[model samples]
Target chain A: MEPLLKVENIEKTYDGKKVLNGISFEMEKGNTKVIIGPSGTGKSTLLRCVNRLSEPEMGKVILDGQVVLDKTVEKEPRIDLNAIRSQVGMVFQNFNLFTHLSVLGNVTLGLTQVKGMKRKDAVERAMIEIDRVGLADKKDAYPALLSGGQQQRVSIARALAMDPKVILFDEPTSALDPELIGEVLQVMIKLAKEGMTMLCVTHEIGFARSVADEIIFLDEGKVLAHEPPEQLFSNNSSARIRTFLKKISELYGGE
Target chain B: METSSGLMIIWESWPMFLSGTITAVQLCILFLGVGVVVAVPVSLSQIYGGKSLKFSASVFEQVFRGLPALVLLFLFYFGLAELDVSPLVAATLAMGLRSAAYQSQIFRGAILSIDSGQMVAARSIGMSRIRAIKCVILPQAIRLAIPPWSNEFANMIKDTSYVFVVGIIELMRQGRYVVAGSFGNALLVYSVIALIYLFLTYCGLFLMGRLSKKLAIPGFASAGAAMERI
Candidate 1:
């Protein structure tokens, strides 16, 4: 079978500086890929480029055998970004919940507005997702009233409600407090156990080690190593990778 | 003249003042109703439209906000008189047009105040930009705009008095008529009219305040009000 999401030779720039230089990756169905890197290493940019949020200067992004983005084409394939995005869910670092809406409203907005599902059906599906994230009781509450973890969970439910083929998580737990990170990680681990296709950018080495099928260590817009957790963490032969791992362990220990 | 005659003059002139109040209120509503309608597009264009559209919106804002309301009233009333535009229509257009410029700025500020992430989150779910604006952004922006937008109501109501220059018999014009007709009892007549003006302004503010309170977001209180509590 074709890879679920394939990103080819993605390059991006800010001003005259290259941010993502010739980055490429592919994920098979049900595979969970975690991207780990220090700040400003184009990890987030790589994820954004997949969805054309930060348009790549040169790239081809294919999702489930469909060409979602082809930056090489002058007039490109007239694809609707909204239609493409509807199938690709993105969970942000800030939660980015619609503050004006209730938990249930936030989860169901895309379903009702984008998918044109009936109100009753959307509510039912949203309820299931909200319940799955353990936020069933807080459906009527607004984002302001919820804790950081709860709000992030709601955002996750919002993305899941779209029934996306693959979910892109951009540091989903980086914004949460230390005590609150476990609940979000637990939810994600459960998704992984159920074989959800996920592309996550995070520094939580503990969650990553336990959950990632393969971890891609990115540096300066290039993938330094792409290997399973045991090989990269247990027996990393490269001094640069070892030094980076040591610094990350010292700062945010592998809990 | 005895105080009794002064009271009698006001009592007799009550109908005139009442009619004047109605016209003033009518004009105020029309100007602001149309002002808000015009402001949405103007503000959206300034913030989201292309270069020429943004420039046009900015030019409109600058020209109208810089010119005095009285000047605009005169230009529309007398300048367009040859075209058979009535004083009322000219006054409405002039004041409404200028109010739209001010209101557009007010709304643009409110729109910008919304988090940029709101649009991203909305679009990530497949919403078109316009749909995101209508559903996710504007609801919050309009709620946030209430306190600032209310000032426009008060400003336009007072500005409606300028229409008297073109001979529309609104509140201020009726007050003048009352004083002149009552043999220069300017003190008593003007006092009653002032009280009436005060009453109308207070009522408008009361209603708007109630509306603002009703629509305010739970945590996102108006910055000025929140600052006061702190």
Candidate 2:
């Protein structure tokens, strides 16, 4: 099958400094790809570029089959940004839950506002995702009242409620307390097992070891290593990969 | 003797004082209503609108906020008299426009103070810019704006007396008439008028407090009233 999401030669810059230097990757349907690297390796930028949230200076991002951003086409390419974003959900480092909205409202906002679903129908649809994230009982609670772990789950449910084809997790659990990280990781693990297509930028080595079909190791805006967990973890793997893995494992112990 | 007679005159002029106070209160309400109507777009333009829109809003802020309310009232009432402006319209436009400038700044500050994360989250869910602002940004920004907005309300009340120059017969104008008729009662009438202004300010602040408490989200009470429990 054609890859569900294809990112090719994406070059981005910030303040005259290259952030993403010619990065390329692809993901088949139901594949969970984890990108790991030290801070500022352009992992988060890569995910943001997919949805055109952060415009790239050069690249072609194809989602399912359509081009979302092709900077080379013209001086300025004007794609349907909101439409592309609707199909590719993103969970941020910060939970970024709408402070004013309740959990149910957060989940249903996209449905009712963008998809034009009736209020009653949107509530019905959002409830499924809320239950999936185990926040069904707290649906009426506002984002401000929830704990970091609970808030991240609600954010996940919010993205899932959009019925997106693929979801991007940008350091989803990085902001959670060490003990709270497990709840969010478990949710992601379950999603991976249930065959959800995800591109996650995370530091959790245990999660990458368990569920990542391919771990893409990025550094200085380039993919240094991209392979299955077993191959990447094997002794014959590059010392660079081993060193990085050792460091991450030390910071975040294996599951 | 003068003090006793001053009280007697003030008592007799209750009807005039009441009418004048009512007009002054009405002016403050209209000032806020018009201020918000203009401020919302002006403030949003500076932040989200294009280069030219930002420039235009900036010019408005400079022109209105730079000038004194007294100067604005004079310019509108006397300078624009050929355009057929009434005293009430003059005062409303003068103070309302000025109030808009200040309120816009308050709103912009509140909107900016809200982490940009809010906008990112809204857009990630596929909400258009306007929808995101309406549903996400403004809800929190408006709550944050309340504390500073109360300041604007209090300021506008005292400035309503500036309309007395154009002869609107509001609180200050009524006080002037009482002093002219009673002679030597200026101190008594003006003192009572000050007390009345203080009462109006108190009421306005109380209302703002209630509004802030009602709108505050559970964990993020950035600029809502301090009297949340009460």
Candidate 3:
């Protein structure tokens, strides 16, 4: 079967300093891949590049056999960017829920606006996702009324309501409080169990161990190590990956 | 001229003052409503539109905001009278356009205060920039604009009286007429009209205050509006 999403040689530079240099990866359908790295290691940049949010100077990102951003195609042909972005939903570290909208409104906005679904149908669809994330009771509550974890779940519900082919989590739990992290991770674990294709940039070692099919260790814009969770956790992993993992577990362990 | 009778005599102009107050309110509503409709797009241009649009919007802001109300009234009333525009119409257009200038800046600042994160999230969910601004950004920004917006409402209420100079006969012009015909102490009559103006201004502000409080963001203070006075 063909890879569901392929990111090839994605090179991005910031202020003449290379942030993502020759990065490449692929996710087959139902695969969950986690990216782990030190700060400013181009992890977040990779995710943004996937959706063409931060335009990579050089790269090809193809989703579901369609070229999202291809240098060769762009010389004469360009993809419909909004259509591509809709298929690839993204969750942010800050949970970035619309402040003025209620939980139901947040989930339903993209449905009614982007997909052009009728209001009644959109609300029906939004309720399913809202229920998936266990936010049915909070549907009328505004983002300001929610805790960090609750807001993140609503954001996840929002992405799910779009019925995306793949979801990108840009350090999804990074901004979450420690106690709140488990609730979001639980929702994610449930998503993975149900075969949701996901690409997560996070330091949750426990999540990578239990859920990610593979974990790629990136350092300074290069993927230094890519291995299965079993080998990665074992001593067979790269010394760099080992050191980073050991360091994080010692600092914020059992995540 | 007796102190007790002075009160009874000024009451004779009550009908005039009442009509004047109603006209003044109508003028305020006309301009303030127009200010909102025009200012939103103008401010959006300033923030998100291309260079030419931004430049044109700024020029609009400067010309309307820089000119005094009296000059705008003069320019519109005198400028449009040649085409047979009525004084009230001319004055409403001028004040409304002027309020739009002030309001656009208010909205612009409020829009800017929102975290860029709000935008990124909107885009991530497949929303176009315009859709995101409409569905996500502006709603929050508009809420933030409320406190300052109410301040603008109060301003327009008093500014409604400025039309008197152009012969619109709102409160001030009507007050002047009543003062002219009165045999009672002129100072007492003028004072009563001043009090009526104060009453109108006060009542309008009270309603606006209630509105701002009702619609304020659930948790956050109106931080976006707070920085705008400078």
Candidate 4:
């Protein structure tokens, strides 16, 4: 079957430095694809480009057979940015929940405004998502009142509330306290078990190993290796991948 | 003897004094309401509107903020009268327009102070740009704007005295009229007028202080309280 999302030869530059240099990848439906790399490896940039938050200098991003970023296509290319964004929900590293809004408000905002649902119906749906993340009790609380772990869980619930076909997580647990990381990872593990399509950029090799169907190790804006977690972690195909895996293993754990 | 006469003057002039104060308060409230109505949208446009629109809004803000309120009132009352405009209309326009400019700056600062992440979060969740700004950004920005807006309200009340130049018989104008009619009781009249203005300003500040306390983020309040103790 064709991939759900295809990124072909995508390149991006910022002030003469190449961030994503002709990088390409594909994600199948209901699979978790983890892009693992060190800082400044352009993992976030790659995700941004795929979500069209940042325009790629060159290449095409095709989602469900729709050309998102094909420069050579038409004179006045039609891109429904909001539609693409709705289809691909993103969870930020900082858990950028609206501090001004209640947890339920944050989750139901898109449903009421974008999807044109009734306020009552939106609240009901939002409550279900909040309950899914075990934050139903805190639904009326603002983000400032929540713990970092709870805030991240609320962020996930907010994303899930949109009912997107694919979710993108950019270092979802990196900003959390070490003790809180387990809760967020557990949430991700549950989502993976339910077969949610996800492309996560993370440093949590353990979460990646436990949840990801495929691992893509990136270095210097290029995909150094792509394989199943078992082969990618144990066999170590590329020298860079081996070095990265070794360092991560030491930092996180063994196995 | 003079102190006794001053007391007698105040007692005798109580009705006129009370009427003038009431009119002045009414005028201040009216102008503030008009100003806010004009300011909120203009400020939003200035912050989120396109470059050309922002530029135009900036020009409107500068023209009103840069000019003295007295000068603006004079320009509206007298200058526009030259073109056959009514004095009351000119006074309303001048006060409302000038207050709009000042209030816009207050709102602009408040809007900018909000985290950009909020807007990003709203948009990422499928809200259109306009809807996100309306639902997410404006509510927080307006809440944060309350403190500065109270300052603006205080300024507006004080500045309503400028409408006296247009011969609109508000408090200051009434004071001038009473002093002139009372045969050179300028000191007594002006003192009463000053007291009235002070009372209005103090009330505004007091109300705003309470509002700010209520609207402040808990973290901010705790930090501020901590700093105050230190």
Candidate 5:
């Protein structure tokens, strides 16, 4: 079967420096794909390119059989950007919640505005998602009042409120405290069990190993390795992967 | 003790003074209302409008803000009289245009102080550029804009005195009328005018203080409180 999302030879350059150079990947439907790399390896850039947040200099991004980003197909390229954005929810490392709005307001904004749901129905739908994230009691509270974990959960709930086909998480728990990280990871694990399609860039190797259907190791804007957890973790395919795993194990202690 | 001159002046002209005071208050209200109406959209255009528009807006802001209000009023009332405009219309245009310049800066700073992430979040949720600005950005921007806006309003109150140069018969013009009658008692007449101005300005500050407090976010209490102290 054809992939749900296809990226063909994407390349991006910023101020004469190549950030993404001839990168390619594909994700099947309902599969959790985890991308791992060191800092400044253009992992975030690659993710943003999928959504056209940072346009790739040369590439094709096909989502659900639609040519989202391509040099060809030029009939008002700006058309349906918001539609595509609503369908593909994204969570950032920083929660990025609007501090002026209540938690419920933050979650319902998209539902009412984008989906054109009535206020009452949107509020009710938002409350259900808030409950799912275990933040029902904090619905009226502003982002400033919530903990880092709670804020990230609210961010997740806000994204999920759109009922997106796929969710992109860019280091969702990286900004949280060690103790708070588990709450976000637990939420993601629950999402994985329900077979939600996700593309995540993270440093949490354990969570990636446990939840990812396929793990793609990236380095210097190129795919270094791609394998399932057991095979990727237990066996050595490349010296680079072996060295990366050893360094990560020493830093984070893998069992 | 003098010769009942001051007493006669008070008795015979009290009605005129009262009527002048009423008109002065009306003038203050009208000028402030016009200033606010012109300021909001001009401010938004400067801050969120694109590069070329912002450049033009900044130039407009600097030109009016740098010119003296009395000079602008003279330019309007006298220079535009050849164009057949009335003094009242000229005063309103001059003062309101000047207030728009200063108010735009006040609002621009407030809007800029808000987190850029707010706009990003609004866009991510599928709000179009106009809707995001109208619904999310402007509400918070206006709320944050209150303290500086109050300062602008206060400045407008003081600057309304410049209308006297165009002979629009506002407070300062009324004071000149009293001084002309009370010839040697210029100090006493001007003191009464100052007291009236003090009353108006203080009342405005009190109302603005309450409004600023109500609009301030809890997380921003310290900054708002600091501004209040200022």
Candidate 6:
């Protein structure tokens, strides 16, 4: 079976300093990949490059057998970048929900505006996803009214309402209180169990252990290790990966 | 010494003053409507449009902002009267254009004060930049712009009095007529005139205050607007 997404030799530079240098990876359908890295290690940049949020100077990102982004595909693109982005949902570290819109409005905006679904149909679809994230009761509440975890769930519902082929989560729980992290992680774990393809950048070691099919360790814009969770956590790993995991578990384990 | 006579003159001319006030209100509404319509696109151009568009918007803003309101009225009224534009139309257009320049800056600051993450999130969910701005950015920015925008409303109310030089009989002109027709009552007549202007300005501010309270997002103050107040 073909992979649902393939990223090849992606390279990104900012101010003449290389951030992502020759990174490549692939995710098959129903696979959950967790990316763990230290700060400014190009993990966020990699996810952004996948969807062309930050234009990578060089790379090819293919989603579901279609080239979503490619340095070579310029001069006339077959697919609209907006269309490509619509298919790739992203959740941010700060929740990034529309503050003016209610939870339902936030979820339904893309469905009605981007997909051209009727308002009635969009509301119905949005409610289903909102309910899926256990936010049915907060549909009418604005982002400002909801807690960070609640807002993040609403953002997830907004993304799910789009029916994306893959979802990119960039530290989705980083801004939440320690108590609030579990609720978001629970929704994510449930999503993984339902076989949604997910690329997550997070430091949640336990969540990675339980829900990730594979964990990809990135350092200095290079993929250092890509292996199953058990293999990555075991003693056989490289000193770099092992040391990084030990430090995080020590730091985040209390939370 | 002449207070009763001054009061009497004002009482007698109350009908004219009332009509003048109505006209002033109409002018304020007209210019504000045009100002907002012009401002939205101008601000959008400065914020999101290309280099040429940004340059043009900046130039338009600078030209109008630097010109005195009286000069703009004179330029539009007497200078352009050969174009067959009525005094009322010309005056409104001049004020509206100048107000648009100010409004555009206010709106652009409000839009910029929004967390850049909002735009990123909107785009991440498949919104084109235009769509994201319209759906996500403007809604929030408009709310944030209200306090400063109301200040503009009050400023425009006072500025409408400048049209008197072009022979438009608005509030200030009406007050002048009352003063001219009376003797030894200038103080009383002028006091009443100041009161009327105060009343109108307060009404505008009160309504805007209510609007701000009604639409305010909890815990979200427009940072740019707050700084602008200082």
Which candidate leads the pack in lDDT? 6
Pairs of residues at least 3 apart in sequence or in different chains that clash in candidate 5: none
In model 4, state the lDDT of residue A123.
Answer: 96
Candidate 6 or 4, higher TM-score: 6
Off by over 4 Å in 3: A74-76, B2-9, B79-85, B220-230
lDDT, residue B214, candidate 1: 89
How high is each candidate's TM-score?
0.97, 0.96, 0.94, 0.92, 0.91, 0.95
Give the runs in model 2 whose Cα sits over 4 Å from its true position.
A75-78, B222-230
Error of 2 at B204 (Å): 1.2
Better of 3 and 6 by lDDT: 6
> What does candidate 6's lDDT look like per residue over A25-54, in tens digits?
999998999999778889999999999999
**Candidate 1 to truth, TM:** 0.97
lDDT (tens digit, per residue) of candidate 3 on B1-230: 47557676567778888898899998999999999999999999999999999999999999999999999999998877788888878987899999999999999988998989999988887889999998888988888888788889888998998899889878888878876766546788778877877888889888878877787766655345455557
Task: Give per-residue lDDT, candidate 5, residue A150.
Answer: 98
Look at candidate 3 and tell me the lDDT of residue B123.
88
Candidate 1 lDDT over residue span A1-255, tens digit each: 889999998999988778898888899989999999778989988998888888888989999988888987888877888988999999999999997899999999999999999999999999999999999999999887789999999999999999999999999999999999989999999998899999999998987899899999999888889889889997644888888888888878885
lDDT of 3 by residue, A1-255 (tens): 889999999999999999998899999999999999899999999999999999998878889999888864548365788888988889999998888888999899999999999999999999999999998999999888799999999999999999999999998999988999999999999999999999999989899999999998899999988878888888987788888999988866845
Instruction: Write one digit per residue (lDDT tens) for candidate 2, span B1-230.
Output: 88899899999988888998999999889988899999999999999999999999999999999998889999999999899999889988998999999999999988887888999988987889999999889988898888888999999888888888987889998888888878757889999899999999999899989998897777778324332325
Q: Model 6, residue A16: what's the lDDT?
A: 89
How much lDDT does candidate 4 score? 0.84
Can you tell me which runs of candidate 1 are displaced by over 4 Å? B222-230
Q: In candidate 5, what are the lDDT values of residues B109-200, reduced to their tens digit?
A: 77777677677767776778788887777777778778778888778788778787777777777777776787556666677678877888
**Which regions of candidate 4 deviate over 4 angstroms?**
B1-6, B213-230
Q: What would the per-residue lDDT of candidate 6 be over residues B90-152, giving only the tens digit for each residue?
A: 987899999999999999988988899999999998899999998999999999899889989
- Model 2 DockQ (Cα-based): 0.75
lDDT of 3 at B208: 76
Worst 10 residues of 2 chain B by lDDT: B221-230
Q: What value does DockQ give for candidate 3?
A: 0.67
Return the clash pairs for model 1, or none.
Answer: none
